[model samples]
Target: MMPLRLLAALRRMLCLCLLAGPALAASPTGWPTPYTQVSGTSVDWLKTKGWWPLTVAWQPAFAGQNATVVALKANALLSRRGLDARFVPMASGVAVNAAISDGSAQLGAGGNFPLTQLVDQGAPIRVIAITAPNLKHQVIVPTASPIQSLSDFKGMQPPATIGLVLGSSAEFYFQAAAATHGLKLGRDVVLKNVSQDEQRRLPAELAAVVPWDPTATQITTDLKSGRAIDVSYPYNVYQGSFFVREALVRDVPDVALAITEALVEAELWLRLNPALAADVMAGQPELRHFSRPLLAQQLAEYNLLYKLSYLYPLGAFWGRQNTDIAMWLFVQGKLGKPLQGADYAARFADGPMTQVFDRLGWKIPARPPYIPADFWMNFVGNTLPAYDTYLTMKGPQAWPEPGDLTKPFSFAGKVHTP
Candidate 1:
């Protein structure tokens, strides 16, 4: 018997799917018809389990997540692949997590902090794929500020107040950088929770603002008033993950694989059509204020590490990073109890991504391609493989668009127009 909450969610899902039937039918690829098999999972097995329309809770504030949403909205991948889904945009990871917790959404996309919190609270959630592994964050100060670096915060008469969307991956980066420089929150510095708009203003009261791109880009490039001191690369390996309810992986495994494949295709489309992708992002209300060129820059930076040959892997190091974050949060009293990486290690579902890469004819990496330590040391003596090696590892899909990033980079049986 299904729980009452889940039953209600299913009913809502069916209603939404019914309303979206016309759109699905109108899709250029058409809706996914009954395939005998998809990614080794029986199509019949999937239908019997009641996996129809899915509600994805995604935050549009982040660049990569926003692009993926734009791709999903354009029916770039989901509909043709037999996954009937609607995307509900959330303001932040907290809202996405809430939607997932209440069963309103089956899959949620968020950064490391939110994913870690979900696992720490013992939600029946498992991370399925890496959406944006190299997502960047920054600590920026006003142009006139006396502060030159993270080290400047030490021994101030009055503790400096830092601004950020608290409890976010920005906070995670700030914390890591602060500790590296021996600065402690509340003693050496104070934190003031600021919204995205507040960060943009670069308020005089706050000594520095920690934000993710294109917000960071906007502050530095668009506004030209803030200068970033410490970026994400050397401080933290900022990552975005798509996590699904454990039941989805357990029952409708094929659906999970389709979701992962759709993400890969969507990102590929994004990489191929960055200008158009930026236009799509600028179409969003919150992003309307940002210029098209700035948006494109954000897209390029976010997609730098995403490779078709390697795709994104949910491997050992990613698990270890999450664990380290969870432990750090717990030690900082952000979480009520101690939680290790092992606590959530079983939640990482890498097989579906492996299958997607297999179909793409790309090499499946044993772990994520880059880490903070690798960036810190410039990869001179790192044991891990470098980005150049991954870039050269392309398969059937790697193309050099004559003018456009290798001729609009083909995928899913059609040349992308926008």
Candidate 2:
């Protein structure tokens, strides 16, 4: 007494099974075949689900700073390992963060500024690893212009406009430079929201452009009139981080671990073979617009490192720097308020990355102490008084400590619950 609907459904399933044949019987139960292998190693849990062709979002810049190299090599590494993944180029870090936030992308890579902003605003993502530090961001002016330094832009007869993308690290550093020169943003000088493309056509009225490479390199190299005046900040160790959605970390941690391992390997490869790495990065479709020489020049400027042993010295400085930037944003009314130490801990998850290091038997490096308050005060310019007062009130709680991987993933001594 089988129901007519049930019988029809059964018949269709039978036909499908018959067509599928012995291949169906031999096939693994749930997960997609040949997509979960990692460097020729396979994990049983990775075979429990069918997540294939992992999507990574990245910002395509001629500068080898973004995860372009890592993403490119990771695809090949995974393919060699029998997994499949691809990196989708987004317009900017903001777009990449949005893509991960909306679940369109499982992972992303970018500078700490936009990524931190997204996490502060409750994006369902966590920074799993810090790939590199000390990326060069500069303020460049035409060689023939009277604006030789940041101070020269102050009190011009006609207000000068600097071209920079809004909500970027360039804007932050530009504001810092103006503050240092006793000038206020929007009053002493104006800022125009210009994209990388628009920067090439910089107007006569534009005093300078604050940009990260390869735009910075391209402009300075192509225009004989261009001269780089100043680097954005002194402790110019701003970092690039890898971010993944919580869902991916929660559901497919092995996949996350595998990707992290692949990236670490890729980083080591890039460091060992800069020439080959440059060639590989330049070959990417997003970067084919630029010449190989430009790509090599940009690559020369970058110092990418991912070894767990190097994390402490770099992470300590970067954590303090990140907190300072966050405080600056809050004071400027860009952020609602300064985020707490626990909040930063929740944003950065070092466990998965540490596990990879442990698996490889790499020794963890010693943790470096936080940078003194005065050093930060000098770095932030005229905001010293306000920053000093804020620090006194909050204590040193917001500054992150070098995480103890042996215990758990914690920042500023609090466990990261997320």
Candidate 3:
């Protein structure tokens, strides 16, 4: 024998080296860096997937995601569900729209603004589900500000610095709301795009943030700790939907249905296991903006929102997308009239939306939800809060009536805001 002691030492070294290899490959230090190999080799199996194997193009703002976890767990879910799919990550709605048109991805998630843009572009996609009308508008005033109601905005200035998740479906609702209330953002009041982390400071000047999400916990905590308060109504009723390419609606409707089934199941799972669901969802890097309590509240809110309109609202495809919003925004001048009538439905395939209801053995209700909250919001929390879609304005019993075609009213060839 070479030497018993030396042989034992060599074996231990080999074991140590084996353990060290993966740690080195993982790059325990650095900014989510790409995995590196110890030396030049035929292949680096450890880093084969690379960073963010996702499509990198269609990056929809998730309510909350543990994308990393979803990435790790998704394939198994798809496999078990018999979904022959790939996560094809894309960075923007523009890219997602292109992918669907080019046949790269059959479906993707996005907000109403982009979908509105898609209709204008004449892209071949359509709405599959109305996830939830955004509840993002918030008139966040510090526990100590003088701004009590919309009237307090008299001398306010822009850059009011309200916290918001940039580029979400909530944008549309805010646009509609500000106009409805005669409040001109970036003018009358400012839209402050601040991160969730920075919000703890409770900036100096904040009239109210639009599409604000302050759950009952946040509300109660704010009351106790004296943080933000309800300057605006609690609900955001802008309609938003889950849309997909039209071809998939017909060709591979089952795949669409399968995905919808996952969403339905995920929604239920979140409802039943809230804290755990938040734990999983928090793992998603994109949705890290929210706190644990906020995330939990969102899961419950989404679960209730989706189940409200119809048992499975997605399956209720009327062969037409809701373009009334487009018309409304166009008149308001926030958008251009891209397309009109039933022709707008050409943007998507309906097989997935329809088949999902069939697969689940649930009934899809009649007519697409003109306003999702009408069916859903009433059932969301223990005591539902009032919404912002339609507000009652004071009539002749109010102000001194001043009539003037000269300046009081002039058609800007569009709907006037103030």
Candidate 4:
């Protein structure tokens, strides 16, 4: 009884629905069903698997980087390619390391300090890329406190106690700074491990709080009662690394490559659209309460230091820096023994990162000459007698000479041995 035109329309509609049925059925809950097929990419693999989920362990503190990843997910970049990506928030780098260790997440980003600590502790993880460098940490004191500089700590009665998160870069820098000034960590001062919130509530007796951004800025801006005494020892060259489980890097390289590409693309997008990226980050649920201007300011600061263009060079440099940090830790008595440059390099998997850059036609810059230990010591303007003494004991042969970064210095299986 239906008209000929209506009958034909009904047939077309039924055919279209039938064609979409499999895609709809294959898509997991809350994921878009791709109508068009993608080929020869990570997304294609996701489509083949019916849009399986990929989990990334994330820290909220890495705002700009976090924003880019979130943007990728929100835009259905992965879904369109036939996969779902999720970011799971973690409290600290330690938590991220634990999650990766237990197989709860495959990818994570964290400061070089904790990452180095974990690697030295024998976690089967590898840093795939150095995403950013020059992250700042500050030592702050109550505006009225008598402790004006590092010199005040020497031979002070009742030894000063500085509040900081243990195993954090803040702690590492604090120890380094104290050592440079001839102050023994346990004997000269007390390091009380405190949370960010606890840092604000530090009693009158506490000497200072050593914290990284947001918390560092918050102490000065929001509290208005704190003053930054000194920036961390390294001063504008500390790094943050993107890490993956060793098994993932070894077993499924494609997934690691895809992640590196995604990160690089996200970083590029952020750079090209800074204002939009800042606004987008401000709207994130975790960051919504923060002022848009504040978020934007933080974004600007991050953009200045971290550039996707220098990814490879930065990774190579940080690989060497990580060993330097390990040696510093050893001299501080925190680490059992020094880590050699080669063992540090072994923890870095550069294959996936190089592949991503190649696919994008990005040129990897020539590696920079290695900065010797004495260079950093002079740069910080603090003579580390203990560190100097330790090097003296090891002799010149054990030290990595300038321009020798390319050659891997052997540990000869002596790592972590007391």
Q: Rank candidates, TM-score, best first.
A: 1, 2, 4, 3
| Winning model by TM-score | 1
Candidate 2's C-alpha runs over 4 A off are: 1-51, 67-71, 304-319, 367-418
In model 1, which runs have C-alpha deviations exceeding 4 angstroms?
Answer: 1-52, 309-311, 371-418
Question: Whole-model lDDT, candidate 2?
Answer: 0.61
Residue 107 CA displacement from its true place in model 4, Å: 0.7
Q: Model 4, 1-418: lDDT tens per residue?
A: 9999999989976765553343332222112223333334654654453434666888776644466566565555545543466788877888888887776777788887777776778888888766544555888899888888877888877788899998677877887778767888767789998876677665676898887776676667766779887776343356677787776567556666666665655655565566877787777787654566766666655542332444553444566557767877788787767877666677788887777555433445454222344553454354321222111323212212222222121121211110
Provide the overall lDDT of each model, using Cα atoms, as 2-decimal numbers.
Answer: 0.69, 0.61, 0.44, 0.62
Which candidate leads in lDDT? 1
List TM-scores for all candidates, in order. Answer: 0.76, 0.73, 0.58, 0.72
**Could you give candidate 3's per-residue lDDT for residues 58-89 as a string of tens digits?**
34244422222243253233344543345655
TM-score of model 4 (CA atoms)? 0.72
In candidate 4, residue 143 scores what lDDT? Answer: 85
- For residues 108-148, write the lDDT of model 2, one tens digit per residue: 87787886687578988877766444456778887787777
The candidate with the higher TM-score, 1 or 3, is: 1
Q: Provide backbone clash counts, one per model.
A: 4, 1, 35, 0
lDDT of 4: 0.62
Give lDDT tens digits, candidate 1, residues 77-98.
6667766677887888889888
RMSD of 4: 15.6
Candidate 1 vs candidate 4: which has greater TM-score? 1
